[model samples]
Target: MLVLLLLWTGCGSAVPPELAPDLILHNAKIITVDPDFRVVEAAAIKGSRFLAVGSNDHVLNLAGSQTSLVDLEGRTAIPGLIDSHIHALHFGWHITKHVNFSTGERLTVESMVARIGEWAKNVPPGKWIYARGPYSLDFVAEGRLPNRWEVDAVTPENPFFMNMQGHVGVVNSYAMRLAGVTKRTPDPEGGKFVRDPKTGELTGIVYEFPAMNPFRGLIPRHSLEDNLNAVRKANEVFNSLGITSVVNLAMPQWEFAVLRQLWRDEGLTVRWTAMLRADARVFLNKPYSEVEAEMRALGPPTRFGNDWLKINGIKIVLDGFVEAAYMREPYLEDIFGKGWRGILLWDRESLKSALRAAGKYGIQVAIHVTGDAAVDVALEVMDEVDREYPVAGRRWSLEHAGVMPTEENLEIAERLKVIISTQQSMGWSIGKTFKKWWGPEMGGIFAPNKTWLQALGHPYLKAGSDNRPINPFIGFWAYLARKDVDGEVAKPEEALGREDTLRLYTSNAAYGIFEEKERGSIEAGKLADLVVLSEDIMSVPEDQVREIKPVMTVVGGKIVFQQGS
Candidate 1:
C-alpha cells in the first residue's frame, strides 16, 4: 500500500513534493462514460487535467493542503457535453447582434414585418439591416418564405437581408438594387432566384448560399468588438448548457481568427473545432482550389491547432435541405412537377476533384449530404478516392446524412470508414412537417437515429444539435421519445435507451471531432471537462430528462458556472 501510494503520488519520481490536485469532487455519482461506462464516487483534478477517479476515500487521498474539496451532495456528474455540429459564429451573431425572430410569439408575415420594422427604427438610416435567423417555414401563414415586397415596405430606406437558417433568404428591393440583381440578372450556378411563375418577376426570395451571396454581401460586416462579444455570449450559452466543446459547422475565416485572438487573450471558454466552409461568394471569392491552397498555406492541417480552437475539416454543402438533396426516388409531385428529383449543388466530377484535393492536402472533408442519392454519389466518390488517395486516416465524415440512408448506404459508410454526423433534434421540430410534405414512406425516416445506431453503434455514429433547435435536452428527449412536437411517433422502434443517448452527445461527439482521446469521458489524465446535473440523467424518468439542468459546469478543472452562484 505504501509503494502504491508513492507511485500514485508521483513520489520517488519527478514530484516537487508540494504538487497536489487543485480541486476534488466527491460523494456523488460520476458517469465516467468509459468503455465499461463505469459510475464512480469521486474525481480529482490537478491543473487542467483529471488526476484520478475512484471511490471518495481513494480520491480524497490525492488531495493536499491546496485542494478545494467539493461535496457533490449526491448530484450527478457527467462529461461536459459536446455539440457535434453548431454554427457558433452565426448563432452568436444572431443572438448578440441581429434581430432574433425566434424569441417572441408565433411569427406570421405581419409579425415578422413588425419585428423587422421595430428593429429598423433603432438603426441609423442607410445602414444595411441584417437578421440571421428565425427559420421556421411553418410559422408563416402562406407556408412560404417572407416576400421581398413585405420587407421593402417595412425597411424601405435600408438595404435588408434576412438569412433563414440556410434554407433561403429574403432580401428587400433596396438590398437587391444595391447588389444590381434585377429580373434580367441570370441566376448564379448552384442556386436560384425565386421568381413569379406567371410574370417572371424576381420574388426577392433567394435560394441556396450562392444565390443569396450577391445581396448578402451588401450587408456591412460587424466590428471586431461585436465579433468578440458574440463569441463570449455564445460561450456563455454553451457553459450554461454544460457544453464545454463544439464542432462549429461552418465558421468564416474572420470568425476563426477572432476565436484564435480570444484564445491568446484568454477569453475563449469552450473548445471549438471549426469545420471551415468553402462556400462560393461568402468566404471564398476565387475557385475552390485557390481556397484550398490558402488553407494549406495557413499553417494548421486538420486538428493541428491548440486545445481551444482547431480546424477539423472542410464543410461542403452538397445540396439544400428542401428541393435539392439529389434524391434517387422522384420527389412526390410538388410545384417543380412529377418526377422532380432534387438537384446536387456540385456535379459528380467537381465533387470528386474537391475530395481528391482535400485528400492530397491531408485535410478531412465533411460533405453535407441529405438525400440517399447524394449518399450514393458520396460513397462512389469516396470509394474511388480510397482506391487512389487512400483516406483511411483522414476521418472524412458525411454531415446530415439526410433522411434516406438506405441499409446499403449504411453498409457503404461503415465499409468506407466514414462517420455519419446527424442531428436527431431536427425531428422534434421539423419531423411532422417533413412527414406531411414528403409523404409517410420517405419522411418517416427523418434523422433515422435508431437505424444508424443499430448499424454503426456509438463510435461511428455521432449526434449534434445543428442549432436547428439548439437545446441539447430537447435532443435527448426526442431520441428517447422518438416522437415529434405534435406527439407523433415517426419511428418508435428507433428510440434509444438513456445511456446510449447520452453517449451520442458525449463520447461519440468527441470521436466526431477527432478529440476522442482528449476530453469526452471521465478518465485519468484527460481534460477535466465535466458537468454536474441537478439530477442523475441516467436514472431519471425518461420523460424528465429534458427537465434536468446542469448545476455546475467545469472546464479545464476551473469552475466556470455554478447554479445560483
Candidate 2:
C-alpha cells in the first residue's frame, strides 16, 4: 500500500532526479512529534537534515538511484530521545576506569566483598581500589550497604573505597586511616561520616562530597586519553538506548576538556551540552567577594561551543535528596534527630554570589534543588539576581524539582519562567526510598510529572535519567504505570499519559538544552535524528514498555547504532 501522505505539502510533488534525497526510510510509522503529532509513513533525509516526512510513496519517490533506502518492515519510529540531565563523564568513569561489580544480577555483601578481594591482589598495598555498583545500595540483595569491616576483610593493606552512587559509600579502615578520618573527626558541613549510634565508632560509611572527598582526593585522576575513551564508551551505551543528545548536569573541567578534544577530532557520537560545575569545595570558606572574582574569571561565557558540544551553564547541587532533601517540614524518619530538615551545601550569601557571577557571564544556571525548601532558597536567590539584572528569558532551570518540590513552588517557577529539568526515569527506583524516609504522605508525591507539566507548560519541563539503569523506558514505565518498586501507583492524580511522557523526553528535553529548533521533532529542515523501535511504543502494554529496545539509532542522518550489525 503506497499511501501518498505528504506531511507538509499535502500534495506529493516530485523533485528533479538531481535534487533527490540522500536517503529514505519507508513503510514505517514515523511518529512526528510536531504540533499536530502526525503519524507519517516514511521520512527522507538529505545530508544531515530531513528532506521530507510523509508516507512511503511520498518519500520513496523522492529517493534517487544514488540514494540509500531502508525498508522498515512496518516498525515504529520516533525522534531520537534527548536526556535533559545526565552525568555521562561520571557514568563513563563508572564503567571504564573503576572496577564494576555488577553483572546483570543483584550484588550481595558476599559477592561484592569477594569481587573486591580478588581485584586487590593485583594492585599494590597503597593503591586505591575504587569499585562501583549498579545504582545504589538499595539494589543490593542484602538490602543494605556492605560494611567497612567486610571491605577491610578483602583488602587489609589497600585503601578500599566502594561506592554505590558517588555520594553514598563505604571505605575500609586503611582508607579511613589514609584519609585521616577517625572516630573523633568532626562531621563536615553538608556531608556525613556515618558512625555507629550505640558504639560511637566510625562505620566507615560516607555521604555527599564533603565527607567523601578525603578518600576521593587520594585516587589518581584519569588521563585525557582515558577520559576520551570513557566518553566514547558512554556514547556507545547512550546510542544503544536511542539517545542522540544529552545535557550533562555536572561535568568537571577535565571531562569537558576530553569532550572538547573529541569535538575537535570529530570523534563524538552523542550530542551533548555540558554544565560546568560550580564546585562548592573550591569556594568553601571563601567570602562572596573572592568567590565572585573567581567566577567572573570563568571565560568563554555560556554557549561557547558548537552544536555537538557546548558549555551552556553552571550546575550547583544545593542539597542531598532522600535523607537530606532540604524540606519545609521535618522528615518522617529523621536520620539526624532534633527535628531536622535537610542542610544546604552553600550558605545564602555564597549562593547569591555564585548566581550573580554566572549571570554576569550570561551563563545559564541549573541548580540541583530537590526539596521544596531548597527550591524556595534557590528562587529567593534567583529573584535577588533578577532584581540586579533581569533573568526573565535566560532559561535557568531547577533540576529534580519535579520529584519533591510542591505545586506552589512549581507555580512560582512558572511565574519566574524558570525551566524544570527533572529525571522522570528515577521515579520507580527511588519511590520506596521516598516512602521510607519521607513517609506515605510525602512519598505519594514521588514524581508529580503532570503537576510539573501543567505548571511549567510542556516545553519548559524537560526529562532525563539522572542515574543508571540509564534506560529512559524505566522512567516511561514509571510515568505510565505510576508504579514504584512495590508496584504501588505513586501519586495517581499526578500521572501522565503516553504522549505527554514522550514529549518530556523528546521535544521538551530538546528545549531544555536550547536545541528544540534543530532536532526535537521529525520535520523537514530538522536534523535527521531518530530511532526505530523493536515494538510499537504507542500500542505496547505499559508493563512491556521497558522491553522496547531500539533497533536502529540515527543521529544527524548518520546511522550510529543498528541491532545485529
Candidate 3:
C-alpha cells in the first residue's frame, strides 16, 4: 500500500504533488527517535514537518519535480539536539563579555590575579572587570578562596573580578567599596558576605544570593540593542555546536522584552523555551491570573516561532550550590567547628503553596535541588503539593538532582513521576572535586546516574549543564562513554548505553519540557529538527565519541547550521 502511494505520486510527474513535500533527503542513515526508535535511510519533508520516513528509494520515489534533494553520502543523522537545562542569557552573556578564568594552567587565586593583571593592561580602568569560570578549590588542598586584597593587587583602580564556579563571584576592594559593603554589613536574607575574623574586613568572597546580588547590580545594564546583539552571538555559538533547541532557565521579564524585539525583527536563529524566574514571594502568592495575562500579552508559546524562540514554563530556584555552603546538608566540619547547613530560599510551607498553585495552573515547575537534604525536602514538597492539586499532565522537574538520595527517596521520585533534569557532564567536570570534598563514602553518592537509572525504571530525563558549557553531544559522550573530552574513560560502571544516552537528550528531555508530541523525535508528523554528525555515535569507540562533530542542523525543514560553512 505504501509502495502504491509512492508509485502513484511518482507516475504523475517528478514532483509528488502540491502540499506533499518540498524536499526529500535520501541515501543516509537517519536515527529517528520515535516510539520504536526507528533508524531509517531517508525521509520526505514538507514545509516544516516530516512527511514520511523509510527506505531511501521509497522516499525518493515520492519526491516531486520541484522537491529539493539532499544526498547524505552515508552520514549519520539524529533528532536536533536540545539542551534541556541552561541559563541561556547567563551563558551568552558570560561567554561574550566576562573574564574567563577557565583558560589558565592553574585555577588558583594567585594565578587568577596574574591573569587579570595582564587583562587590565588592554582594558581601560573604571569599567567593571567581569570574569567567570574558575574552580578555586580544584587545585589547593586547603582550597584558598580569593579575597578582595588579591584582586586589588591586580587592578586596584579597576574592579578586578572572577566568578567562583559561575554561581558566586569575588570582587576587588575597589568594587566592594563601590558597592558600600563593609565589615558591619549584615548578610542579606538569602545571601552571604564573607569577612575576616581578625581584621573584621570584607573578604570579597560572596556566596549564593547575597554575594551575587550586589555584583550583578554593579555590571552595566544591557540596552535592548545590546541584548539583541547578545542573542545573535548566542545563536551563532549554539549553531556551531549543532544545538537546535534550548530551555533558557529563569528568563527575566526585561530580557523577554528584548527576545520579543528580536522575534519582531526576525533576527533569532535558534529555538528557545523560556522559563520565567518567579521570585519566592511572587510565586508563593500564586499569581496565576497576572502571569497568564502577561503571557497572553506576550503571545502564546511558539514551538519554532520563526524557528527561533518559544516559552515552556517557569523556573524556581529553591537552593544554592553545594560547594558554596548554601546546600542544606550538614557539613562534617565547619571552619572552626561553626556549622552551616546552607540556606533555603523559602520555607517548606511557602514552597508547597507556590508549587501547588503552579501545578493547578498547568505551569511546569523546574526546581533547583542540589544537596541530598535539599532534594529530600524538595521532593517532599512536590509530593505533598501533587497529592493535593493532582496535576494530571504537568511535567514537574527537579533540576540538578546531583547528590544521591536514599533509595526510598528515589522510589518516591519514580512514584511521583518527577523528571530528574540532571547534568551528566558533571561526572567528568565536577566529579574530581566531589571526590575530594566528599571523601570516598560521600563521593560515591554524588551524581549516581547509573543508580538513578536503575531505580527510576526509565522515567528520568538527563538534562543539565547548569553551570558548565552547554553541549548535548559532549554530555552524551561523557554520560554514556564515561570519558573526558580527551577520551579518557573515568568510571565505566556508571556509563549508560548509547541508545539510553540518546533518549536522555531527545525523548526524555522533550517530555521534561512538555513538548514530547511536537518535537524530541523524528516521526511522520513531527517537526523536522535534526542533526547530522560526522560519525555514528552508536558504532564509535567509547573514547572517540567526543571527537564527533555535528555537520548539519535542521529545524523545521530549514538548515540552520552547516559545519565549516
Candidate 4:
C-alpha cells in the first residue's frame, strides 16, 4: 500500500512519507559532501533518493516498521565515485571478443603464435585469434616483431591480429591478405603501414588506429547475448569498486545501444551517459559533407535522455596519444621521424566547419587534446563555435588536457567554462616513459592535477581511469602519491589533495554530465548512490590510498554490491 502511495504520489508532490524512510543506515560516518562537506552520522533512503541525512537519532526516528535498517558498525560512507571519461563498450568488447592475454602478462611473438595455434586446434575453425595490449616486440624474446612468413606458418588457417597498446599492431599474413593489405596500398592519413627499413618491403606492422582500420574492419561481429554478458561482467566489476556512474564514450555507438537494453532489463547498476565518437575515419567511403550532415542530423540533441541513460553528445579526437600529441614546439627528438611535433588527426578549417555544424544543431561538442598546440586548435574552434552557441555553463569538455597544460590554455578553458576530463593513470601506465620519450620539460607536463585544480575548481576537473585499471583507488594513488609502476615518483610537484581528488571523482564528475543537481552528493532530495569504505580514503596515509576498498556499494537506494557477498 505504501509502495502504491509512492507510485501514485510520484517523486514530486513531496510525498508525506518523510516520516517513514524505506531504508535507514546508521552507526556510520556519512560524508555528505554537500556545500558544507558535512559529516553526518546517518542517512535515510526512501525509494531512489535520500529522504533525510542527519544524526543517527534523527534518521532512526524517521524509519517505520517496513523500512530496511542496516547497522554499518562505524564504517565510513562517501558519495559513489564517477568515472568522468571512459571507453565503456571497448572494455566490454574485449571479453566477448575472446581476448587471449591475461592481466600483466608479458607478451611475446612466439607465445602469441603458440596461443593462436592452440586456439585454431581447440576452439574450432573460422574464429579470429585476437589479443591487444602493450604487447610490442620490446617484450618478444627475440627483441623484434615476427614478420609475415613467421606468423603465416601458424595462422594460415585462421586470421590473427594483435594491437600493441592500440598504438602499433602486428598482423599475420592470413589476416593481412583477407583484409586486402598490398605492398602498393598507400598509407592512410595520420597512420602508417610500417615497411622493412632495409628491404623496403611491407613488414606487416601497422602504426596508429587509422592504419589498423581496414584490418580491424575484417573481424566478425560478436552476438548480442555475448555482448550483453560482457557488459554485465563489466558492471559487476564497477559496482565492486563503488562506481555508480560513468561518462562513456562508446566509439562504435553499438555499445551505447546494448547498454540501454541492459538498463531496460534492470541489469545496469551504474548510471551511464554516452558520447558517440565523431570519427570521420569510420565513414571511409562517405564524403565530409555527408558526415557533417549526419552530425547535424543527430537526433534528440544533447542531454536528451533521462537520469539512467542519456545522450551526452559527440566526442571529436583531434590528435593522437602522448608522442603523437600535436605540440606547440617540435619534439626534443624526432621520435616518429616525421619531423616530429605531433600527428594532427584532422586539418584545421575542415574540423572547424565540422564543429560549427555540430554546434549549430545544439549538439554538445567534446574535443580531445593532449598537446599544447592541439589545445590551442581545440580552444580556438570552441571559442568561435561558442560565440554562436554560447558555451558558458554548457559543459563543453576538453578530454585528456593533462599531457601539455599551459597557463594560457588553462585561462582560456576557464573563461569558456570547459570541463577538463583527465586521467592520471596515463602516468602510471606509461610508467617511466615520460622522461625518455618526451624530455624532462615535457615529462613535467604529464598530468599537473594540482595546477589544473588551481585553474579549474574541483567541479570543472573530472577524474577517470581512462580504460585500464578502472579502480578509482589505483588512479587516486597515482594522483596523490605521484608514483609510477616502477615505484618512482613521476613528478612530486603535481600531486593532488585527497579532498580535491574525491570531489573530482564525485560531485565534479556529476557536473560534467549535467547530473549534479540530481546526484553527486549525499544531501536530501539527491540520489542515494554511495559507498561504504573499509578505510577512510581521506584519513589514510598517502602511500596507502590504493589499499582502500569499498565494503559495500549502493546505487539508487539499493545495495548493488557488498564485499562479502
User: Where is the poorest 10-residue window by lDDT in model 1?
Assistant: 9-18
- Which predicted model would earn the best lDDT? 2
C-alpha lDDT of residue 439 in model 2? 71
For candidate 4, what's the RMSD? 4.5
Clashing pairs in 1: none
lDDT digits (tens) for residues 205-314 of candidate 4: 88888789888999877788888887887788888988999888735567778887898986578888888878756432355687568786654478888878888788
TM-score for each candidate, following the candidate numbering:
0.90, 0.92, 0.88, 0.89
Looking at candidate 4, what is the lDDT of residue 422?
79
lDDT by candidate, in order shown: 0.79, 0.80, 0.71, 0.76
Pick the winner on lDDT between candidates 3 and 4: 4
Residues 214-296, candidate 3: write the lDDT tens digits.
Answer: 77787787666767777877877777777777888888878877888877888566677788776765544445565445434
Models sorted by TM-score, best on top: 2, 1, 4, 3
Residue runs of model 3 more than 4 Å from their true location after superposition? 1-13, 16-20, 102-111, 135-146, 184-192, 195-201, 281-308, 324-329, 332-337, 444-446, 481-492
Off by over 4 Å in 1: 1-17, 103-105, 140-142, 182-190, 195-203, 280-299, 333-338
Model 3 accuracy (lDDT, Cα):
0.71
The lowest-lDDT stretch of 10 consecutive residues in candidate 3 is 298-307
lDDT of 3 at 368: 80
